[model samples]
Target: MTPQQEPPPFLGTWARVYWGVVLYLAAVIGVLMLFTASFRL
Candidate 1:
């Protein structure tokens, strides 16, 4: 027997939530890289 699971609160599905988190992490990394590059001499 299998147990029922609940959907993510925001994105509705687990896959979408995972993708959203990935995209958010990528964006944050990109911004941080840019910030670091600008400060480099």
Candidate 2:
């Protein structure tokens, strides 16, 4: 008997979701910084 190994199918989907969250957070932080900088100037 031989054992077979296969990669998980949800790996790609989860990776994309994780990246999306990171990008969204970065955008939000950037907007906040811009707003704060404009107010300070």
Candidate 3:
């Protein structure tokens, strides 16, 4: 008989959520940087 593999845990879900938040923050920071650079004389 073949051994059965266990399903992945909730950590994967948490990791995805964490990654999404990080990407969102990075996007916001990038936009702010662009805005500030545009305002510079």
Best by TM-score: 1
- Against the reference, the lDDT scores of all candidates come to 0.89, 0.73, 0.75
Indicate the residue-level lDDT of 1 in model 3: 31
Any runs in candidate 3 off by more than 4 Å, and if so which? 1-12
Q: How much lDDT does candidate 2 score?
A: 0.73
* Candidate 2 deviant stretches above 4 angstroms: 1-12
Clashing pairs in 2: none
Lowest summed lDDT across 10 adjacent residues in model 1 is found at: 1-10
Tell me the TM-score of each prediction against the true structure: 0.78, 0.64, 0.61
The residue-by-residue lDDT of candidate 3 on 1-41, one tens digit each, is 33333323544565676887899999999999999999899
Q: After superposition, how far is residue 35 of candidate 1 from its true place, in Å?
A: 0.5
lDDT of 2 by residue, 8-35 (tens): 3554565676877899999999999998
Per-candidate count of clashing residue pairs (backbone under 3 Å): 0, 0, 0
TM accuracy, model 2: 0.64
Position 10, candidate 3: lDDT? 44
